[model samples]
Target: MIEEIRIENLGVIAGARVELGAGLTAITGETGAGKTMLLTGLGLLLGGRADAAVVRAGATSASAEGVFLVEPGSPAAERALEAGAELDDGALTALRTVAAAGRSRAFLGGRTVPQSVLAELAEHLVTVHGQADQVRLRSAARQRSALDAFAGPTHGRLLEDYRAAWTERQRLTVELAELVDSAQERVREAELLRLGLVEVERVDPQPGEDLELAQEAERLGHAEDLRQAAQVAHDALMGTDDAQAPPGAAALTDLARRTLEVVARHDEALGALAGRLADVGYVLDDLAADLARYADEVQADPGRLAAVQDRRAALGTLTRAHGGTVDDVLAWASTAGLRLVELEQGDDRTAELRARLEDLTGDLQALADQISSGRAEAAERLGAAVTQELAGLAMASATFSVRLTPTPELGPWGAEDVEMLLAAHAGAPVLPLGQGASGGELSRVMLAIEVALATAPSSARPPTFVFDEVDAGVGGRAAVEVGRRLAELARGGAQVLVVTHLAQVAAFADRHVVVAKTEGDVVTTTDVRVVAGPERVAELARMLSGQEDSATALQHAAELLERSAVGR
Candidate 1:
């Protein structure tokens, strides 16, 4: 509930503070006395869009602040707390400011916050209805929502379930479609993977096999040249059996050693030289034996060379397609093998998804049927209730109906479209609300619908309700009924604020506030104050007639107030 509202520099409302409490509070003023500004201020506090043009002339900024009282653990309080707002004894302060330069800011519980936070809190705190809403009620979607709201909490839960199932069904439908549409593509992909795997398996390339084979092939190809080189070196190191061959290194070395040995008995230095020559002859003998063994082992084998080349060519085929090396090809095979397993299971996966989608489709159909049934039942009750209310609001002959037309397919809300229809009088053909009802009838119809919805067993009423001239085209007894219903709504444990021009409605209020305007040379200012006793009557009289002092108007205003008191 809103405890108080303070507005400054907004429109012609330079500065005004209005205190509010339980029950009905009526706000009234002359045509241009800034009554609309009061609601605009409230809208700002409720996080409505801000226009710099609303700022008072010569003022730098305009601001609206509201103090709201909420239950300790209410959703509104919890949301405020979540925004780092400090509630003072269950009272939360919301402030909005619009600078003349077009910038806007919002503050909640003394902390700066985005304007959306204020909007979120407003949903739990209050419900504001205006003439604009009466126009909105003509929409089919809006009618459906209103009917759903009146269907009680059980229906609401069922509707939520239906929506959840509907959402899941939609997702499953898309996925199943994709899988089915790409079936042939998936088959082709699996075939390609299978062929690649077969090719790799036939080659059977091992890690580093290509490199090893290359080295072996090179040695085999040069076998004859290697053998010839080894034979020539061996003949040079040791004397060959051929007589034409000159004395080899070994023969020369042995002769030098004997010459040194003969001189060793005559000189000690000659004996050391003979020992070095003997070591050289031993090294030459070892080299010659090694060279002879190498020449005999080096034999060209064409069959082995051809086999190595063939193996290399086979490994090369795998390399060119998959990688630059045999090891790379092996790595590719390992990854492709895993992917092949997945591709091979596509049919199984497709079957599984189709089965799940079938089950989900059945579930959705069941939920939609339940929702349609609930809506049909609730629509009848709500239509009857609102029609009953319309009778009291001076439309005794009018018939209100909530018509549910079955749709070809299920919608987000249900399997039908809801529309509100009305018959203005007996014998008049029933038409949609927008087409059949006049402005006055529409206003009454909107009020009657509100009253009917408020009486729903499972509907949770907001702490506060603001009606901005919802009685726009209503007057006479119809206007009085409007006030009576608003008062009853307030008396049922909620605060009701009605901005009205009708004196009958003003008379029904527990409190009356008048916005008086003062025109200055440079600017216009509005003063908002609560009126009671004769002052309130005078205000009502002024609303009834052009003069507050008119004797007949005052008498009528007093009589209306008396009747309202008795009715209350």
Candidate 2:
């Protein structure tokens, strides 16, 4: 139930704050009493699209806000989360503002939101029916939606699963189609990758091999000069009679031995000299062995050199173009291998696709059956309830039926088509609702449906239903019956707001709000007030007899209230 609604500078409503409660709330007045303006304000609050013309003549902007108490895990909360919105506990406060400059804004739970959020919130908030809703009933989509709504939780889950699988299948089919349609293009691409990968495989370079090879080539190129210098040093170190000869490995060893021989003669000094000569001999011997190895290994094989050069050149080509590393080439090869396989094996891909199609179709059929069965059960119960509602609205002779027709072809929804059929009087012959919904009969039919489904709200406080012109052409007994029906619908839950000129309808209200127009210097204003107790009687009497002082009208108004109390 809507707890409160406030409007400012919107159409004929300059400023108004209407506090609402659980059960039926009737707003009534004379012709041009701004009853429709109140509904317009409500529409704006519910996040309806706006026109700047709604702003008052002297105002730059129009604003509307509503507060509702919702259940903790209601559909409204789920919708909020789905839309990436946050709610304040279980309560919701929605505000919408429209500027004369053609700009509009919406706020939910104090955070700014897109108009789309408002549209979603409105689903759980209110179900407003003017003449527009009657026309919507003729649509197949609306009928389908109604059927789905009537379906219980089992059908709901099945429809959800079916939709999920259907979407997955659609996505897979699109990808498969793209891959198949571009087969020739894929062939060209595969050819290009194969050439690149083959070149890389031919080389088969290892990690860091290119850098190591570069270093080796530089060292080999300097081998000749290194060998010449090493030979000269060897000759100097081993010269037998040369003065100032550099001591070779053998000479150093002999000097160490001579020092050690005098170890017994010259105690400390000779011992130290011997140890130092021993260290020098060790270093000299190690150096001589390394030099010999270097000289021996400096091979001058031109053929081997040519082969190394050719290999290096081939590797360098790939390195410079792709990356200066063999690892990069390996990565490219791995990627291309998968593509090549896909391009070469078309039959295997088709087989996999056929298998996938079978699985998806099977899943869809199971889900559809679940949905259909649940809907069958829901339709039975819902049809019975709606039939009872119609009786309360004085349609006792009318026949209402939920017609479920099975379809072989599965659409986005499922394989069942549901329709609501009706007959105005006994033996009138049942017909589609669209054909029979004339002379205000459709409005009452929709009313019955809405009342039955009203409990399925997104919040604990179901939105107040606003019927702008439900009693458009109805009056007297029928009008009274409409009011009684609205009151009856409001019994279990929800706040019903009916804008009408019928006094009998107004008599059924727990609260009767009267809208009066007041003219000022520069602008005209609309004010609404709650008429209670005896004052309510005056309003009802005025609606009844077009005069407030009629004794009969007052007595009838009192009688209506007395009857209303007993029903409650």
RMSD of each: 7.1, 6.9
Give the per-residue lDDT digits (tens) of candidate 2, residues 1-568.
Answer: 5778788888777887787787888888777756777778778767677999988888899888887777667787777666665666666787889999989998877778888887877777787888788888877778777767766455667788989998988887886787778878877887898888888888888777777777777767777877877766655444446677676656858666685867646587777777777777677767767777777787666676667778789888887767757677667677779878978776577668768978998889888887877778777877887787778777888878888888878767888788888887788879888797565677778888777676543223246687877876566566667888888777866678888778777778877788877765111233678889888998888888898789998998889888777756
Which residue pairs show backbone clashes in model 2?
1-461, 1-462, 71-460
User: Scored by Cα lDDT, where does model 1 land?
Assistant: 0.88
Alpha-carbon deviation at 476 in model 1, angstroms: 1.5
**TM per model?**
0.79, 0.73
RMSD of 2: 6.9
Candidate 1 Cα outliers beyond 4 Å, as residue runs: 50-61, 99-103, 204-335, 520-526
The parts of candidate 2 lying over 4 Å away from their true place are 71-93, 107-122, 182-192, 205-331, 341-350, 427-429, 455-463, 520-526, 541-568
User: lDDT of each prediction vs. the true structure?
Assistant: 0.88, 0.76
- lDDT score at residue 99, model 1, on the 0-100 scale: 99
Model 1 lDDT per residue over 1-568, tens place: 8999898889877888889988999999888788888889989888899999999889999999999999999999999999999999989999999999999999999999999999898888888899899889999888998998898878889888888888887887787788789889978887887888899888888789999999999989999999999999998888789898798989999999998898799988889999999999999999999999999999999999999999999888889998999999989888988887877777788788888878877877888888889899998999899999888888999999998999998788878999999998888899998898889899989888887887777877677888999999888889998888888878877788999999989899999989888765111333688899999989999999978999999999999999999878
